[model samples]
Each structure stands twice: as structure tokens, then as C-alpha cells.
Target: MKPIRIVCGTRESRQDFSTKTALGRSLLIHEAANPVDLMLFAENKQGLSSIYNRAIDEAKEDPAILVFVHDDVHLCDFSWSERLREAVETFDVIGLAGNTRRLAGQPAWAFVDDRFTWDEKRYLSGIVGHGSSFPCNVSNFGPVPQACKLLDGLFLAADSERLWEANVRFDEQFEFHFYDMDFCRSAELGGLSMGTWPLSVVHESGGAFGTPMWRESYRRYQAKYAEGGEPTPQETSVQKQTPVHQFHNPDLLKLMPTNAKRVVEIGCSSGALAREYKKLNPDVHYIGIEIDPSYAQLAREHCDRVLDMNIETVSAQLLAEDLAADCWVFGDVLEHLYDPWQLLQKIREASAPGSCVVACIPNAQHWSVQARLSVGDFRYEDSGLFDRTHIRWFTLVTMLELFTQAGLTVEAGVPRVFDEPQRERFLPAIHAMAAAAGRDPEMAVQDALPLQYVFRAVVS
Candidate 1:
């Protein structure tokens, strides 16, 4: 297949001209290094829409796919183009691109001017320029969806014929910003389909024009839209969706004793697992405790009983008296606590003797982690074993120690599935390490670093 043709447009700066020029040159060099075709254009302070239109016009005769990206953004994953192409074909949309904070609209102007506080959802509705790709189908002026009305400027693509026919030009009235929103709105009104896929590109928020341009744009929007009465912004509500566990560890679920009549799940987020337990043991009574009121409410709807209280603050005696549970679960909960062992001791005291304690703690010492640390990459973020909110970290040995100290005897211990690409990249090394550690070396790499360490222990 012919490689996609990517085009980028930027302006030369006198003060930072060398820096900006080097940046643009580096992008071209990187693109070539990836063996991808790239054509770049640098102009002096032209409207973004004008630059885009010129690039589109220049590439009109080329039979290859056209991809437009902002100069400020960096391509992290080299396979993004292929993934984006696949998504575009699957979704049948004109373009696919990355997520951005500033979208097209009036509220964004108010936000820029400090006239309004930031609402996480609406911040993007006002300024719409982003990275996007265009497919051949977009060559014909097509109807787009209402949801995409304000996001027109990011990375977008279209066929050569429709690009000229639709006269699909960004409104110069927007000058610096809002052109993307205007364009997307125009596309939607004219019947075109524009969408954003799960694939992403890294965008450095403010690399070009600084705060002055933002202030000016805010003034322009206020002048244009404020007089016409504020655009009735769309209201978006957080929807309650079912928790989909892609990593299935049935052995962890089996740890619950069949004869148990009562069960308690501490930190049951949305009560999904508790509901599963109820299904497994239909006659058993289940009670779940959650710190978040919203999740607790959802849990109540799914299970027989739910308590809206933080485990740390809730009196142990009160919880013990409320539900004399024979089985207690601490699934994926210990990592977030200040003192998991203390909580485990309380749970041990609260539950009946011989009650099963099913705990799922992510193994921090998994081989993949060791490799990442060996490379001097200790930076942590949300999710995974090193999730930012995790106040406590654990390894297989530490976790076993905690459970044993809590007066529990292990019945079963196994690793949970670790399927994330970054973590999976460490699997071969992990398998080798597991073998070196004199553990189950023959185990499949998929089983080497289970997403979590699931322990089924009986209270002794």
C-alpha cells in the first residue's frame, strides 16, 4: 500500500525562529526515519485554516491518503497511522484524531476570560483545532453527526474531489480559534461524518502563540456570540455503565467457601464482584461497603445490602455487628489504603473463624516492573500497578507476609493476567526471572505477571 502523505504548516518566529525551524525540521526528519512520506510548509502567521486549505489544495492531485497534524504535536507510537487507518475504515468517517481540551464554542471564551469556572466537559467545546486524517470518502461533501458539531479543525481528512466541491473552508472570522468548531458545525449541518477514534497523538498544549492570542480570541468570541445570547451549551451527564473486567481470574472467585451463608466485600466498587458472588452462591446473604456514595448507591441497586462509608472511618464493631459475614473480600483494595495490614487485622477480627479472605493485590515486583526500573523509568501515573493513587505498594512476598501476619492460611495463590502492552512487553523477561527464581518457569508468559496477585486464605 502507498504510504499516507502527512502535511504540517507553521509560522517562522524571529525571536524563536531557530527553535521553531529546528522543531519543524525534526518532525520531518522523524517522519522520514519512520519511512513515512511527509511534506511540510512553513509560512508567516497565516490563519491556520488558510494554511490547511493551501496544503489540501497542493495535495489534491496525489492519489495517496492525506494526514494533517499540528506542528506542536509529537507522534509517540509509529504504528498510529496504521491503527488510525483501521479505525477510519471500521467507523467509515472522514477523519480520526487525538483528544484535546479546547473545543469550539462560546463557553470556552468565557472560561478564557475568567468569566466562568472550568467545567471539565465543556472546556473543549469552544476551541476546536486538533490533529486529524482524511479518507477518500470525505472527497464528497457529506453529512456529519450532531455530536461532532464543534470539533472540525483537529486532524481531518477528505477525498480530493469533495475537498474542493464542499467549499469546506474554515471561517476566517474565527481568525485564530473557533474555526474548527465552525467547520465541524458546517460539516454536521451539511451532512458529513466526523469522528475521533481511540488512537492518540501527543499535543503540547501551548507551543505557538502564547496567552496574548488566547486573550484576543476570547474577546472575539465574546463580541460575536455574547450579543446573540450565550450558546445554550450541551449538558452531559456521567452515565452508569457496567464494569467490564477484561482480565478474568475465575480461581480468585472460587476461593469463596460454598457452605458460607454470609459474605462481605470491603471496597466493592459498584458491587460488580459482589453481584458475581451472589450469582455463585444464590442462598448466601451479601453486604458491601464502598467509600464513594455514587458507587454505593449503584451497589445497593445490584446487591441485597450496601453501606456508604469509608472503611477507615467506619467502626469495626459496627461493621462486625451489622453483618456477621463468613467470607470477606479485599479485591484490588489494599493498594489504596494507608495501612492495609491494619485493615486486614480488623477484617480478621470482624469475620467468623474459618472465613475465607479473598485478596487481589497487584504484584509490584512483577518482572516487567523490574525491567522498567532497570531502564531508569520510575515515573508513575494513573492505573496499572504503579497507579498514582496507590498509597501502598506490594510484591508477592510482602503480600504473603501481610496475609500470614493477619492470621490467615493461604489456600490458593496465583498471578492475575497482565495484558497491557507496556506490562506485556516485560513478559519474556518475567518468564525468565520466574524460572531463575525457581518458581513455575513453564507457565505461559501471560500468567507470569497476573494483573493482580489473587490470594485465597482461610482465617486461622
Candidate 2:
């Protein structure tokens, strides 16, 4: 590891003067022993190309890790060098700040390297530039795993050698916006990994320009990424499909007939999904049965009818007589059951002939999860495929078999997209566990199984 180099890109405009002052104050307060260099470019100073050119030139003679900081950010941590060095060693790209909301024009911290491939997107951690440790812990911040994408240009560190080798410098095109995206895209293309660590730094939003200019910059960014040829059509398509709701399969609703007269949802916590079905097809009367009283109350609030009884203890005959549903929904509920097979049997006995059974289950065999487990990292949490409450895990084959054994047939099934950071984090580990259990990680990874499975079956 070499001495960390800090570069601040500033403009000569009046707006930039404040940013320069803030950076100057941060340097003096932190008393950084290493020589910190500052570069001020005009507001229209030929975009970020000039800044990168100067940085490359500075590092050309003596190569070192370059830590780029924006004017609005302040360095709270004195030992940022050490933590940044560690992150740079582990991840190809390291981001310093975390944002609660996704800022326009800024890249979201998504996608991390799992050795084999990148995992889900994530958020950076810490105060933007306040003097906290490089791996500083801030409240409400989660794991900034080395596999996530770099978010924001507030603060970041990267190896000079690797960056130059990949020719992945920030793109100066479009003046200001999309520089981060261009750089990240180039890094991904160049086979470099990216992530954020628990580095704390404070950042004042829109330091360089006022809100108006910031909005303009974001507009340009959106236009470039949206219309520009930089992000390939496939990349754009993938990005378009990257919304949060895209993770759930809308087709799962298709499992139920449009004119389904009666429907039952098992383990309907909150009845959110059941309510959605009811809204979509109002003609289909919906009934939700929940074991938890608290959640049952929530379901009752949202759903038409709620059964506040545990599926395991309830009598099949009584449940069947209570509401003869044409369809049964097991959306993300089976895995949490103490005995999924027993519940399935009960449902089978209760269901009418040709009644549709829809189920969703998370694949325990995603690739990223496999990589984590292969490296000996298995921490149990409250939820996910390895949720502490989960007594059973299922892959595609086993899930299908479970349904088939219960006298049901699969009609349509597809992997749902998993684009969220939290869910993506567990994927590698799940896949690893599945592989160790001699299961196919690829099939398990496919259909983005809701860390629980979603299945649609017909009761024979």
C-alpha cells in the first residue's frame, strides 16, 4: 500500500469558493500528515476530463491510491487512509458516503463482486467526509460489502495501477453528470470489483452548485444515461428492469384464474399480497389465514376476511368448510412453516378438485450465497433463506417435488428478479450452501426465487 492521495475537484465560480473553504477547513482540522493536494477547476472547466487528466498526470510519476473527494464533503476520520487502503485491497472501487435516498445523477451502490460475479447493489456507509475512521460505523448503515457498486462522488478510493490498467477513468463527457456511471461501467467492463466500507465522512448536499444547477446536472445525467449510447441497450434494459417491485413476479397472479370465485392465502402476514390480488380481480373473494395474531390484525385491516389461527393446528375439515376457495396462495409462507409438508397435505385435503395452488420460495442455491459459504461466512439473521425461523429450505427441484408429492401439478413458474441489496447479499451464501448440499446452484439462482418460493399448483 502506498500513501493515500486526496484530490478535490473544484470550480472557480463563486459557488465553488465555499466548497474550497470547507475542504481547506477539513484539512486543517484533521491535520492530515500526508501531503493533501487540491485542484480547482472552473465551473465550465472542460467537465471532469481535466480533473482526471491532472490526477493521472500527478500519479504518472509516482503511482499511489487516489481518493477523490467533492467540495461539500468533510473528513471526520483521521485514519481514513488505513481503512481506505484495506477496502482498496479488497474491492476494486471504494465509496465513502452513504445516502438514505437515491440521488439523481449519482450511481446507486449496487452490485458487488462475489469472486465469481457481482452481487446486488448496496449503499455506502458513514458521514460523507466528517473525520471518522476509514471503516467508521454510522447509525442505520448496513454492511458495505466489497461486491456493491460505488454510489455518489462524495468520497472514493481506487488503485491507480488497476484504474490506469483498465483505462477506466471518469468520463468527462456530458460535462459533469454521468461521470460516476461512466467510470463504474468502465470498471465493470474492465473486470474490476467495486464496493463501499464503513468509512464515515459528512457531506452537505449540493455543495458545488445550488439546487437549480444540481437539478440541471441531474437532468443531463438522466438524458445521457437514458438516451446516450454509453450504457449499451442491454444495460439500459437491465437497468429499466431494476425497480424494487420487479423482484416479485407479477405472473404469479396469473396462477389464479381471472374469474377465480374464491381464494385463500396461507400464512398471509399483513395480507399485503392477498389484498393486491383482491384489488386486481375484485370478483375473486379473498380469505387470508395467519398464525400470528398481530399480523392477523394487520391482515384483517387490509383483507376482506382473516382467519386468526395457525395452519399447523387448525383442522383441515373445518378450514375447508369455512371458505371453499377456488385458489390457494402460499406466497413466501411455506419456508417459514415448521412442517411445510404437513401444511401442504392439509391444504391438499382441504382444496377442491382442480383448485389452483400458488407458491413462492427462495432458492437456497444462488451463486453469491455459495461464494460466501465457500469462504466460511454464514451468519444467521431474522429473515432470508437462512432466516432463524426457517425450518425448511427448498430449491426448484425439491419445491416442485414437494408440490407433486402433495398431489399438485405445476402450471407456470419463473424466477423473480432480485435487485435489492439486502436480498442480493444473501444470494451468494445461499448458493454456496446449496452447492455443498449437492444441489444445482444455477437452477436455484434462476427465477430469482423469493428468498422463499412462489409456486402455483393444481390440486389433483
lDDT of each: 0.56, 0.60
lDDT of 1 by residue, 102-187 (tens): 22233331232234554344323222223332211111112222123234344565443444544455556665565554555444
Candidate 2 lDDT, 1-460, residue by residue in tens: 4656767666557464543555555666765553554445546356665586578667867788887767656666677566777788798777754332222233333222112122222333433333323443333345554354345566667878888775666656535554665566456435566676776566555334334654465555555433221332222222111111213346567666777887877767766676567677877667777655456567775566665444554445444755467887776767766577876777788777888788777777555445557788877665665555555777767898888887778877766655666656666666675599897776555634444445677877
Q: For every candidate structure, what is the RMSD over all alpha carbons to the true structure, in angstroms?
A: 22.3, 22.7
Off by over 4 Å in 2: 1-251, 419-453
* Window of ten residues with lowest summed lDDT in model 1: 133-142
Quality of model 2 by C-alpha lDDT: 0.60
